[model samples]
Target: MDLYKIDKQNMEKIIGSNFDLERGLQNLIENNLELTLGLEFVASEFTVGKYRLDTVAYDRDLNSFVIIEYKKSSKYSVIDQGFAYLNTLLNHKVDFTLRFNESFPEQKKVEDFEWGQVKIIYIAGSFTSYQMDAINNPALPIELFEARKYKNGYMTLNQIMKTSIPARFSHTHNQHKREVADKGINIDNASELTAPTEEQLLETSSENIRDLYQSMKDSLLEWDSSFEIKPTKLYIGFRLNHRNVVDFLPQKNALKVWMNLSKGELNDPEKLTRDVSHTGHWGNGDYELKIKNDEQLEYILSLLKQSWQQHRIEH
Candidate 1:
């Protein structure tokens, strides 16, 4: 894609530039990892056994570790390298936990992390067609991102989405095709990494609360095709443009909604939102609201729309 700048009602094309060094790309991403990818930076050049990972990041929402590898070349096999890193982490979970604990003030046990949600991301200026096709499977935990730098001091990083491949394909197809078995690595056993489903999260909710949550979910999904429902251990997150715009936690009697906006960013004339900026919370953002019924569902949706707009702009 091409980028353009408008000046005096005239459009000027922004020339793209190449990253002279892979370290330059790594530094750029690591410094702004939170803003660019919504992940917390852990360690750089992390070494595990024989492998020296470029960047180690933690996903707070998923409670998982994300291994990022930056590439300036298109010769390596992403599938092989991604699985290798995954294997390394799986075999040495304790080391990673120690790193996490040492890097941050907050501490967590090894079991506290969701190992199944662990993934590897490949960032490069471009990827080969063969590499793109390899990650077309929906079940693959690997992601490919293309980072383009412009001469106008601007850069755009975008994920290379998979094609319309059927999700029903055998999950072991890629592993077998890539012959990862030679190294005694098994990618088929993903049962341990499975995350809680939406149905499972709503199992403890009362009938009224379940209905309210369903209504809100259906409305948000229908409102925007880009919205995604990601059910975590604590709540069901509504994501827009890869960022959480809102989250819903269903209780026994009511549905709690957390808007992904800052303390004063929300414009609520009715003053229905509670400011949780200073309080410890499970969900993202500083605004929280509890809804037992749909009496003010429309107004709540409007408030959520403001968050959606803000996330869209910021992202």
Candidate 2:
């Protein structure tokens, strides 16, 4: 995509600049980890055995550690390096848990974290078609982000989407299965490794709660076609252009929602949303709302729209 500056009906192309890999892009992302990826920074250059991880971040939504590698050059293989890091993390889960505990003293127990949801993220200015193809598996918990910096101090970060390919190959050689040495990844084991699906989460909810969640889901989709519904073990996330706007935690009687807006940015005229900036919550954002009926559904959605628009503007 091309960026341009328009003045008096004349447009000027904005040239992009590149900086030193580690000193430039990597540091920039590390400093802005929370804003860019909704992840908490753990430790940089984290070493386990002989391998050194570029950046270690905590995914609060999934309660897992995410391994991130930044590449200024496109000469490396995503499959080999990504899986290698994942294997290292799987082997040294305790170290990661301890690191998180030390970095943020709020989390108390090792058992509270989700070790199975450990994912790998590779970020670069751009990726080659071959590199993109190397980690395009749907079941694989790997993500690729492309970062672009413009001359006008504007930057863009986009996740390279995976191609829709049918699973015809055997699981023995699949990337998801190959991550584990002998016991290949299967449906039974996948429950422990990956996030739960919308079906799985809604299955435990009562009839009325399920209906209420369905109504909210429909409204969320209708609000923006680009919004995606991502279900984790604890909650269902709604995002637009890779930025999470809201998350839903379904209960037997009510649905708990957390908006991505900041502490006081939410404009809740009805005072329905609670300020959770200081409180420890399962979802993102400082604002939370509990919905149980259809009467306030429209009003709640309006509040959610404010959050969605605020995130859109910030990104």
Candidate 3:
């Protein structure tokens, strides 16, 4: 279980159970590549130039990737290996677009995708002091996680170290963009706003845009009574009238209502996230507020109220 103890028997046993060391590490590196780039999961492995990576994780929100080299048996110097793959990732980022276009052929505005950060991860049962010291002063931005295996062979990867949590989420409207964009920030031109583009056109005639947002926001406030609106440059987060929905344990299977306006269907689509486990679609079109039903809403409010009240007492 504590594979990090670095004993010969424990290390070898884990490698034997997990992989031919080399083969098994390669499989995990390929499969969980998503963890590197902060995406949910890569869903598959891919080659970088001539060199194959253990795993290549990509996060769509960050528009970034990570190179993973897993060591099932013994440790090898990954500096050169990770460096090679990192270069290739930066080089062939456009290939992602090509692959994407194959799926959705009409994606002409593909240049908007921005590449963020790349992390290098070493997943293994053990790491030598020398290896740890080497990674301590990384040449490129990298993170190293050590996987500890149990007697039952239940391996849990523990975060040994991380570069920073700046890239935690995919939403980027500020500094992250400045780093990715080779060019300095360009000021928005007022004249450009006058120009008519398809994106602008779609939002122009939508009557339900305001009406829908107000209705949804009002309903949330009505339910929680204290649901205030707070907008950030990226997306909105809320203090969630937790007093009302404190006990609402939302699960994956819970009917979650997400306000999705079709991409390319409109500019400034009325995008919101609502759990629709019980609520019906409110109104229709852009004004469509999908939450669970009235009963569910009441339950959510009750749970949130209890949570907020508990917090007040704790504070």
Candidate 4:
């Protein structure tokens, strides 16, 4: 993909620019972690054992620590380095807790952190085919983000998404035992780290609610090929470039959606969205809406389009 700059009737291609991996990109991302990625900034160049992390950010939604690495070139293995950093975090939980506490004393208890969903992100100008192939497996909790720097101080983070990989096994003790033995590492169990499937998440919902959720989900996917659905323990998140645009929390009778837009950014003429800026919510965005039926489905979708358009790289 390419970027362009428009001036009145004239248009010009914005050439990609080089940047210092640490000083330029890393610092910029850390400074706007919450604004850009919806993550809380924790520390930079944080050392644990022999490894020094490029950036350590906290995800309050999942209550997990995020490890981010910036790569100027695609020379190293993303899987090896991602897991190595995750392994370090898993082994030395106390050190991470201390670091978080030192940085944010008012935050939640360290024991309550969700270690099961620890995510590692690798950001670079581009990824090789080998690097893309390495993350095709669903067993890994890592994400690849392609970063681009243009002439007019524009930076884009595009997540390279992989096709869906079916889960190896679910709800079988024997399978779990085999996976445990196969890992051979004295680490946490594999079941705990495995992300729940969409079916598993909607199992408790009523038939009507499930149908409604599916309708909205199908519509979102039909909007574009870039739209991807990620089902987490808390909610089903829809994203472009791995940056969440909207999140859905399904109940027995209703589906709640949290759009990833700021307080005043949303253009809600129907007045269906409530201000959730100061209130504690399970999902992102300042706008929250609940749908019990398909009465306002089209209107709701129009609102979602606003969010999707705002987050992507504007032409």
Candidate 5:
């Protein structure tokens, strides 16, 4: 509180003593509007007609806008402020829907924004019992942690920031960990196939499946560019997103799904469940097709595409 201290050398300690992190953030954003929006400086205090927001972070990637509010908590709670900020942001954007395809015709597309899809996170040094409760039941995006100075008394908060508001463990990360958890069969396994024709053989037997897999995969992408692969024993199945498809198989946690190739085509493989047991990774993850004969690859390729569709219909 001393206003007479004019020593520049002791300024850091003084500033640290009065760091006021929340205010520092606010001031930083106000001074350099670009910092807040992560884009060019817009306005000190952006007023969308009538509402005034602390900072507006816009991303052209998804054509989205995020309203950020900084807080310095002397007490323990700042949940109310977060909710208020969310309210203001949503109110101002009564008609503000994300329209990205209009900008990037080939990159990505987003439909709409629901309150549930949006998030409001409260950042503070220490969260209170009340604040935690606020973020609990309805899944509010409130996160709290003490901000400390680097050896230099300057630290940023993005290190521990959640991937998404109300951040949950990413499904992709969970899938990988699940694969790692399973004891892998230590047999050296690799297979490749070339060309979309010819019973699509070339398994652990030939090195051609690689070309065939890539050719088919590339062709599949022409249908849906976002399609990705999740490998199994004989082949990898293409899907929009692994997370959604994996959800279809309730008990299967591992990504590498093992189906009976010798059992027959997709229709009769259900009966071949005898020799076919999951590699413990029945879910979606990267994998190599372990086919011995080209016929197996053809069966696998056909069943791989058919299995998912059938599962969808059956479900």
Candidate 6:
């Protein structure tokens, strides 16, 4: 995409600047991890065994760890390095867990995190075609992002989305499997490695509640294509720009919704939302509402829209 500056009603092409050092890029991303990637900054230059990771971030929504690597040049193999980092994280779970506990005031057990949802993210000015192809498989827990810094202190970070869906590897090579096995890595099926499926999450609700949840979900998606549905162990979250805008937890008779807004941030005229800021809750934010039927679906959607708009503006 071309960027331009309007100078006296004329267009001036804005040139992008290259990052002089990898450290600068790392610092920029680490400081703005939450705004850019919706992740909590954990540690920088975190060393595990022989490898020194660029940035170690935690995903609060997924309850997982994200390993980020910044590169000034696209000379490395993303697949090999990504898997190696994953292997390191899985092998040294205790070290990572201890690091998290030490970094934050709240202490959590190692089993509290969703280890299977752990993923690697590579950020560079550009990526090679081969590197892009390496992560074409949907089953791969790897993401590529291109970060560009332009003049006038403007910067843009965009994910390099895969163009094609490649077939998954049917079986691992005997030698490769043996090598990973020796390193104490179990190559489990991809299905078992992620969070609960949407279908499974909805199974907890009755047929009417499921239908109501689906209706709200479809409306949310229709409002914005960028919104994504992320199903965790407790609830299904509707995310905008990787941040949770709203969370839906379907009950046997009712569907619970939580908006990702603070106490005073949301503008509720009808007083439809319950303030859960002082109360302990499983969802993301302070506002919580229950939907037993679709009679007030429109009003509920309006409430959710407030959260979506607030999040977008704040971020």
User: What is the C-alpha local distance difference test score of each model?
Assistant: 0.83, 0.78, 0.42, 0.79, 0.38, 0.82
What are the per-residue Cα lDDT tens digits for candidate 1 across 171-279?
3444333454544465453443344557667888899889888777787777776786677778888887657889998888888889998878999999999999999
Which order, best to worst by TM-score? 6, 1, 2, 4, 3, 5
Report the candidate with higher lDDT, 1 versus 5: 1
* Candidate 5 structure quality by residue, lDDT tens digits, 1-315: 222335766643333232355667666655654432333222335565445655555432113445555556646444555544544454544433322233233444233432322333334444456555444522333344343334444544431323333223244334323322232311111001010111222233234444544545554465456543323223344444222221112111212233322233345453322333234433332221333334444455554555445434543
Q: Which ten residues in a row have the lowest lDDT in candidate 5?
A: 186-195
> Model 2: per-residue lDDT, tens digit, 1-315?
567889999999887654556457878889999888878899999999569999999876667889989888889978777766776677677788788889996965767877666788988888899988866766677899988898657888888888766354344234444454334334444434544557667777899999998887888778777786777777888976556789999987889999998877888888999999999987889999988878888889899889878877776
Q: Which has the better lDDT: candidate 1, or candidate 4?
A: 1
Q: Pick the candidate with the highest TM-score.
A: 6
Q: State, as a TM-score between 0 and 1, how close model 3 is to the true structure.
A: 0.42
In order of appearance, the predictions have TM-scores of: 0.78, 0.76, 0.42, 0.73, 0.35, 0.84
lDDT of 6 by residue, 1-315 (tens): 567889898998887766888899999999999889989998999999879999999998889999999999889988778877888887788888999999899898878888867889999888899999887755467899988898768888989876663332333234334444543457752333443556667876899999998888888888788886777778889888888899999889999899999899888888989999999999999999988998888888899988888877875
Give the alpha carbon lDDT tens digit for every residue of 136-176 in model 4: 76656788988888755688877787776565346433443
Question: Deviation in angstroms for 13 in model 3?
Answer: 15
Q: After superposing candidate 6, which stretches have Cα over 4 Å from the reference?
A: 7-10, 162-184, 188-192, 264-272
State the local distance difference test value for candidate 4: 0.79
Name the candidate, 2 or 5, with the larger lDDT value. 2
Arrange candidates by lDDT, descending.
1, 6, 4, 2, 3, 5
- TM-score winner between candidates 3 and 6: 6
Off by over 4 Å in 3: 1-19, 26-38, 41-45, 73-75, 99-110, 137-139, 162-315
Model 1, backbone clash pairs (residues 3+ apart or across chains), number: 1
